[model samples]
Target: MTVVLALEKVTKSFGPVEVLHGVDLALHTGEVHALIGENGAGKSTIMKILGGYLAPTTGRVLLDGAPVTYHSGPEGEAQGVVVIHQEFNLAADLTVAGNIFLGREITRGLGLDHAAMRAATAELLARLDTSIRPEALIRDLSVPDRQMVEIAKALSRKARVLIMDEPSAALTHREVEALYAQVDRLRAEGVALMFCSHRLDEVSRLADRITVLRDGSVVQRSLRGEMTEDGMAAAMVGRELTDIFPPKDTTTGETLLEVRGLNVQNLVKDVSLTLHKGEVLGIAGLVGSGRTELAEGIVGLRPATGEIRIGGRQVQIRSPRDARAAGLAYLTEDRKEAGLLLDKNLPVNLTLSALDMWGFRIDPKREKAEMTRARKEFDIRAASDEMRTGALSGGNQQKLLLAKTMLTGPEIVIIDEPTRGIDIGTKQQIYHFVRALARQGKAVIVISSELPEVIGLSDRVLVMRMGRIAGEVEGAAITEENIVRLAMGLDREEEPA
Candidate 1:
């Protein structure tokens, strides 16, 4: 195998602070090289350097055993290098075909060739086994569909070197299978692929070579057979992660929140549930299974006809303000878009929800004081408090969201996708935080797509399928097998004819 892309003695610095410290990496053709690290561990910086989105402060980018310089990402793409960013880079108003062929349009005669582009886009989407239409606008698609589009766009570039960041983070189990097939095909075709994922299982299954980075430096490098999953985890965080979940609270107290006959448009139908003090309840479901919709309805983010009782008193919560007044807080699943003000500073975002408590005059000193406390409490690592909230790593952003939600001082909290797209180390922190909330006698409801997370965190699991609650599992019964059976309707299928 030959090295197609190489970074030699690379060091990257942002203003006064240095992020990457004398890093070395190599990508070979016909191989999947996995770059595993904790969030903000310089993995993205490395990817950007290789794909020509950013230049190294000091070092060389070698192509075919010789040094080369690409002034821009497009220039690198011209040399068969493509990058699929973690944050999507598509025009929301454009059609799927339009986005795929945005910079390089297929022209015929005088104007744009709409038919030809649509046909080509359809073929590319078909390769990924996705049903997204080429004519559909980007804004009309789901997160998983958007992810598939990014992959299809990269494929359309005829990339020789593809760098993917968290490609499977938003996808469902079926979509992941489809993606795996494409990865295998690409590997067979001699494409050098470098992917970064928090899922160590994915890296173990797909990677031919593994490099673990901790705090901007490569800590360990190994071949497929040389490393175990536990070993990789330990190397990434520099500690033993044998116990990821906190111990489940055995004693649940009196019912604190109750919902009866809840209907959220047509997405959720007659869903009824209860949350008791000192209990962490998990909701597990497939995509479009109405798990999020049910949460939204309960929190008044969505219109619903239901009976919601808090502390044995029926309350009318037609909006988020009403919900907050009724002692409830909801953490949205889409953290980047809905949960945080990315362009604003940390202090502004952290206190956005609880601004009413600081009186109408708006005190900046109080906000800064609270942000300092939040940083220490939530373990939100960052270079400076003045930087944009968007610059924080995924784990830090999630922690900030948790802190913001907690500041509302609600007794009942609903967190959706609590640890999505974060490192294993951070996942442990989040799990413990959820348990800590439970131990404080606060009723918590956690909704997640990962079965293992649901099983580990929830004292009781509610499995939702197509706008309805399929079943519930508790204690020893809350296994992945039981939850999946409910989510997939396998239990119903197994019933007597």
Candidate 2:
């Protein structure tokens, strides 16, 4: 393998906070070097330095053993370097081919080379074995296809140094496999890749070498033969995850909520289920399979036609406010988008949902007391309850979301991707919390894309596929293979007698 790029003594700081401290890495041709760490562990910072988006305070970046400084955008682009962030830079109004050649359009004298750009994009998509039509508008494309378009755009730039951040974050398992195949192909073609991801298993499967960063410094650099998924995770967080999902006691109580003929577009179609008090009902599915949608619809976040009974009393929930008034709290999947008030203080978020329902409260002392207790109960680590929720880490943010909902004292709680973007230790904490809610006689519904989490947490698993209940498996009967098979509509077994 040929050494394509190198980072030496790369130190970076913003104001008084240093993000990277003498981080070193080397990427050889045909290499898939994975950089992984906690959310704020400087993975993105290092990538930005390499891609010329940000300059390091002190460092030497080398290409072919020769020191090369990256100062401006054109400099990195000219040297076969491109960085693809999780937030795709595609224009939704533009056509797919148009997005691929956005600023650097092929021109014919005074006009654009529309025919050539389309052809090139088509060729790139074909090479990646993607089914995205180059002529299709970006708005019409699915999330995975949009990602493919992003990859196509990077490839069109003649990129040899490709940095993909959380590339499979929104991808289904099958889409992830497709992406892995393309990454492998790109590697074989001598493209040096540094992929940053939270998915440790994916890094272990695809990366030729693994670099784990902890607190902005290199903790471990394991070669192909040395890295295991568990080892990578251990090195990344500097601790062993004894119980990713702590064991749960599954003795369920009385039925606290019941649903009948639940129908919602793109999410649920005639979905019927019952969530018992002191029991967890998990909705499991692949990405885009209506797991999150069902949760949102039931919580009145979307247009829905359904029968929901809380504690055997029928209630109509038209909106989120109505849902909360009816004793239902929903924790949305994307915390930044739906689950949090980033600008608000932690105490405010925790008490906001319950203030109207519980009684109009202007008592700062009581609110602070409640927030302090819940924070400790949920292990929400931050500077203070007065601190902005946005300033907290992913795990702390998730815990805060949970704390906010628990403060509502709802009879039914719906959590979508409860542990997403959180660490394993935090995940276990969340698992314990959900189980405790059931034990406290709250009807709990957990919607998760992760099969293990759903199976592990559920008293009964309801598998959703294409806006319908695919299958319902008893909690004890849940296995990854069965859950996936049922989720994909492969099983034709009768619903629990």
Candidate 3:
């Protein structure tokens, strides 16, 4: 194998804090190198350096073993290096083919070649086994489709060295399989691939070589079969993580929330559920199964016709404000887009939901004091409390969001995709947090696409299929096989007596 790109003794610093510490990494042709780490472990920093998005403060970038400087990402791309960021970088207003060939379009007699670009995009999408049309606008695509588009755009670059960050984070199980197939094809084509993911199972399956990063330093590097998933996790967190989920709550209390005959237009139909105090109810399903839509409808984020009861009393929830007033809170799955003000500081974001508690005048001191409390309570780690919310790591941002939601002091909580893109260590923290809420006699609803998460966290699981509750599982029956069967509509028989 040839060393296509290498980072030699690299150190990166952002003002007073140095993130990378004399790191050394290399990518070889026809191989997949998996980078595994906790959030804030500097995985993103390393990827940025290798992809020429950021220059290393101390060492050199070696292209074919020769020192080279890339002033910008395009400079690196010009040399056959491309990076697909975890965040979608597509233009929402542009068509798929247009975005794929945005800067480098085929020209014919002083005009853009739309037909040729669309044909090429169609070929790329077909290669990825996707149904996305070349003429479709990016804004109309789902999260998984958007991810595939990003991958297609990178593939269009004809990159020799390709870097991907959390490529499967937004994809469903089937879409993930499609992505893996493409990855295998790329590897067979002799493209050097490096990707970071929170999903350890992916690393176990696809990686030819694995690198474990902890606290901005390389902790372990091994060939295939040298490290187990558990070993990689231990290396990343520097602890033996025996279990990630808290023990399920064995007790239940009075009914806190009930939704009967709920309908969210065409998206969610006739969904009904009940939440009891001191219990966690898990909603599990595939993407487009209407799990999120149901939650959004219940919380008044979407228009819905339903009979909602709080504390055995009927209530009308026309908006999120009404839901909040009725002692209900919702944590949106798309936290970056819908939940928080990315450019705002901590105090502002923290106190935005519960501003009524402070009356007409906003008190800066009280807000900062509450933020300080939340940092301690939720274990939110950041360089400074005054920093923009977007600058924090995914785990820390999630914790901050949890804290913000809790500030509303709701008796009923609905958390959607609680650990969507966070690291393992933070996931454990969140699981414990949910269990603690249950212990405090609060009713909680957890909606997730990860079956293991639902089985481990919920006292009872409701499987959603095409906008309705397909079936329910509880106790010893909440297994992946059972939930998947329900989500896929493979089983219609009643539960065993």
Candidate 4:
């Protein structure tokens, strides 16, 4: 293997705080190097340095066996290094072709070569087996499609060293398969790949070498077949995690939320479910299986035709506000866009959801008090209470969002992808919080793509397929095998009665 890029004893700091210390890594051509770490363990910081978005305080970056410096991200790209950020970077209002060609448009005569750009964009997307139109505005595409656009943009750069941050976080099983094929092709082409993901299974499958980071230092590195998922996780967190999930709540109370024959237009159809106080109901399914749409229907985020009963009384919920008034709160899966106002301060984002309680007037003192309480109670780790929500780490932003949802004082809470993109440590904290909510007699509904998460956290699990409930598993019967079978529409034998 030939080294394409190498970081030797890199140390990075922000102001007076040092986040990374003496970290060393190397990316080899035709190989995928997996970088694993808990949130705030300096994974993103290292990536920033590698992609030329940040400069290391100390140590050297070597390109092709010689020390090199990149003055800017574009400079690094010019040197055959490119990064696909975890967050979507496409301009929502621009067409897919326009976004892919932005700042590097093909020119014909005196104007942009729109035809050539569109043709190139189509070719790139087609290579990934995606059907997204080059002329489609990014804002109109789904989350998975938007992610494909990001990948296509990266592909257009003709990168020799590609750094992908959580590339499959928003993709479905089928989409992931397509991505895997693309990765294999890139590997065969001798491109060096640095893959970062919280999903340990993906690392196990794709990485030729695995590097585990803990507290900003490299704790372990192993070649393929040298480490298991459990070993990788233990290394990343620096502990043997015995139980990832908290003990399930055994008690049940009166039914707090009931949906009968709910339909969300063409997305979800005739879904019926019930949630009781002191219960954590898990919704599990493949992406595009309508699990999210069903939740949106129940929470009035999407228009629906059905009966929604809160506290055994049927109610009309025309919008999210109506659902909130009916004692229901929804935490969306896409926290960056729908859940948090990233540009605002913590106090503002924390109180925005429950502003009705403040009488429609801004109260700085009251808001500050609430923010202080939330930061302490939710274990939100940030530089200060005044820090912008966008500036906080992914895990802390999730904590603040959870805290914000709780501030509404709803009796029923529906949290979708409660811990997606969160590290194992933060995931444990979230699980604890959800269990605590159930113990307090609040009806909780958790929807997740990770099967282990669904089985670990829920007292009962509902599997959806195509637009309807496929099956239900309860108590000790809730297992990954059972859930996957149901999700894939496989036949299962009846248990001995």
Candidate 5:
């Protein structure tokens, strides 16, 4: 393998805070280098330097063994290095073709070559095994399709060095397999790939070499064969990860939330379940299986018809406010979009959910005090409470969202994808927090795509298939095989005849 891009003793600083410290990495042609780290561990900083979005405060970046500097992302792309950001970079108002060729349109004679751009976009999408129309507006596309658009855009640059951050975070299992196939094709073409993901299994399968970062410094770098998932996790967190999940609770109290015949329009249908105080009920299903839809319906985020009983008394929850008044709260899966006001300060976002608690005339002193307490309690890492919510890393942002949800003081809490895109260490922390909530007698519902996460954290697991409960597993019966069988509609318990 030939070295294509190399960072020698790189150190990056934002103002006075140094995030990347004396780091060194090399990307070889035809090799996938997996970058593993907890949020705030300096992975993003290093990626920014590599993508030319930021210049390293010290150290040198060498391309083809010669030192070089790129003044901007476009300059880096023009030189055969392209970055696919974790967040979607497409303009929502533009068509797929427009986004793919934005600022680099292929002009034939004079005006913008619309037909050429659309045809080229079609070819890229076809290569990625997607059927999205190039003429479709980005705002109308699903999350998965938007991700495909991002990939197609990157492919359009004819990149020699590709940097992908959490590329599979929003993809379904089938979609991920497709992405893996694309990665293999890219590698075969001798592209140097820097793949960053919190999914260790992905790193294990796709990487030729692995680099681990801890506390803004390189901790370990080794061949893929030299490290197991457990070893990599331990290295990234600097501790032996024993019992990643807390002990399951067996002493559940009386049922706190009960839903019968719940229907969320076309999304969820006739789903029934019960959650008890001191219990973490897990919901597991494939994409579009109505797991999130059911939770949204129960918490009034979506219009639904159902019999919702709180403490055995029937209640009507028509809106989020109504649900809150009924002692119920929901943490949406897309925390960056729906859950947190990213542009706002920490104090503002933290208190937004519980504004009624302080009345109409908001008290800045009380808000600041509450923000301080939540930050301490949730272990939200930030430079200061006044920092923008978007400035925090994914894990810390998730912690802040969780803190905001808990501030509503709901007796029943429903969290969707609690640790999606978060690192292993932060995931352990969230698992403990969920169990602690149950121990405090709050009924908890965890909806996740990761079967292991659902099984490890929940007292009982409910599998959904096509908008309804397929089966329930508990105790020793909640294995991956059983959950998959239930989710795929291959197995179901017989009803009393």
Candidate 6:
């Protein structure tokens, strides 16, 4: 393999606090490199520097043996380097062809020529073996369709180096397969791919090399198969991870949660379910499925006509506070928007739900004690108690969010995409934590898009499709094909069983 890009002791920092210590990374042509680390570990910082989103504090970046520094994505684009972020950059209102050649539109030696751009975009999609219509508006497209356009956009720039972060989070098995084929095509074309994901299974299949980041520094960097996941996980966390999820043997009581005639807008229609004590009920669905809305409605985050019962007692919940008071908790799908107060500190975020639990006013000792316990248990690393949570890595921030709701000790918890943007190590911790919650006799509901995660954690599974429960398939029927079939509105068994 030929060296495509290399970082020589690159160091990046923001203000007085250093986010990334001196670190080195290298990638060769025609290979997929996996970057693994905890949430606050400096993975994004390194990628940002390479992609020209941020300048390195020290050291150098070399592209094919030539030292270079970039000031923006366009500058990097001029050098054939592109970073496709987790959030799709295409404009929703624009047509696929328009987004592909947004800035560099073809012209008839004068003004913009729509004909040429559409023709070119159509060819590009066809080349990728996709039947996506270039004239179709992105707003009407699916997540997978949007991703395919993004991939086509990258190729339009002739991107030599591509960075994919959590590409599989919103994809189904079939979509993932199509994406993998595209990735292989890119790799075969001598494009160097640096991928980041929380899914170790993906890393095991795709990456030709792996680099482990821990505490703002490089812990291990080696060719493919040189290190095992167990070894990589230990290095990334700087400790032995005996069990990601704690063993659970706690037997649940009788049916602890019951829902009836739940009806909301297009997100959730008439639906109902029952959850037993100490049961982890998994809700699997594709993007835009009714799973999230159902969780929200049950917790009173959204307006709905439904009856929610805890331990056979009917309760009235109209707001988040009402939900908490009713012994229920919810972790939102979008962490930035719903789960966290990005500007706050770890203690403040962790104690968000249980402020009253600390007594009148704010007892310094009790508040500190509560925050300290969550920090230690969740393994949230920060410079000090005074440090802001926003400065932490994505993984640590997510952990603090988990600590936020669970601190209240709610009887039933609703968690949406618990490990979406986190790292593999953090994901492992969450799997154990969720299982442990059920073990402690908590009725836990996990809304997820990942099949493996749902199957691994749930005691029962509810599959949703198009604002309704498509089918309730537990134990013997929770296969990947069935879950997705229900999620995509293909399964015929309806009626919200």
Candidate number achieving the greatest lDDT relative to the actual structure: 1
What does candidate 3's lDDT look like per residue over 279-315, in tens digits?
Answer: 9999999999999889889889899997999999999
Best-to-worst TM-score order: 1, 3, 5, 4, 2, 6
The TM-score between candidate 3 and the true structure equals 0.97
Better of 4 and 5 by TM-score: 5
Instruction: Write down the RMSD of candidate 5 (Cα, Å).
Output: 2.3
| Candidate 6 lDDT by residue in tens digits, 408-459 | 8799999988988787677888898888788778899998877878877877
State the lDDT of candidate 1 residue by residue for 1-497, as single tens digits: 98999999999999999999999999999999999999989899999999999999999999988999999999999999999999899999999999999989999998999999999999999988889999999999888899999999999999999999999999999889999898999999999999999998999899999999999999999999899999999999999997799988558999999999999999999999999999999999999999999999998899999899999999999988898888899999889989999999898888888876555456888888899999999999988999999999999999999999999899999999998899999999999999999999999999998888999999999999999999999999999899999999998855586
Angstrom error at residue 109, model 3: 2.9
Error (Å) of candidate 3 at residue 438 is: 0.7
Query: Which tens-of-lDDT digit does each residue in 1-497 have in candidate 2?
Result: 98888889999987777889998899888999999887668887888888888888898888889998878756888899888876667898999999999889999999999999999989998876777888999988766678778877887887888888778766767777778888888898999999988777888788889888898999888888697778877787788867776566766777778889988874578888888877888888877777777887788888889898888899898898999888899997778756788899987888877788657765788888988798789887775678788877788888888888877778889998888656555677789888888777787889887787888888889888888888888845888888889888888766896
Judging by lDDT, tell me the better candidate of 1 and 2.
Answer: 1
In candidate 5, which residue ranges exceed 4 Å CA deviation? 106-116, 492-497
Off by over 4 Å in 6: 13-22, 87-153, 225-231, 238-243, 266-269, 316-318, 343-370, 384-388, 407-409, 465-497
Total clashes in model 1, counting residue pairs 3 or more apart in sequence or in different chains: 0
Residue-by-residue lDDT tens digits, candidate 5, 1-497: 99999999999888899888899999999999999999999888888889899999999999999999999988899889999998788899999999999998989788999999999999998888877999999998877788889988998888999999999988888788888998999999999999899999999999999999998899899997899999999999999999999998558999999999999988998888899989999999998899888988888888999799999999999888899899999999988778899999998998897887667567899898888899889999899888889999999999999999999899999999999889999999999999999989999999998888998998899999999888999989989999999999888566799
Off by over 4 Å in 3: 493-497
lDDT values for all models:
0.93, 0.82, 0.92, 0.92, 0.91, 0.82
Clash pairs, candidate 6, are 39-393, 39-395, 40-393, 245-432
lDDT of 3: 0.92
Q: Please give, for residues 1-497, the per-residue lDDT of candidate 4 as tens digits.
A: 99999999999988898889999999999999999999888888888899998899999899999999989889999999999998888899999999999999999999999999999999998898888999999999988899999999999999999999999988888788899998999999999999889988899899999999998999999999999988988888888877789998459899999999999988998899999999999999998899989988887888999999999999999888898899999999999999999998999999997877667888999999998999888999988887789988899999999999999899999999999888888898899999999999999999998888899999999999999999999988999989999999894567799
Candidate 5's TM-score reads 0.96
In TM-score terms, which candidate is top? 1
Clashes of 4: 0
Candidate 2 clashing pairs? 278-438
Deviating ranges (above 4 Å) for candidate 1: 493-497
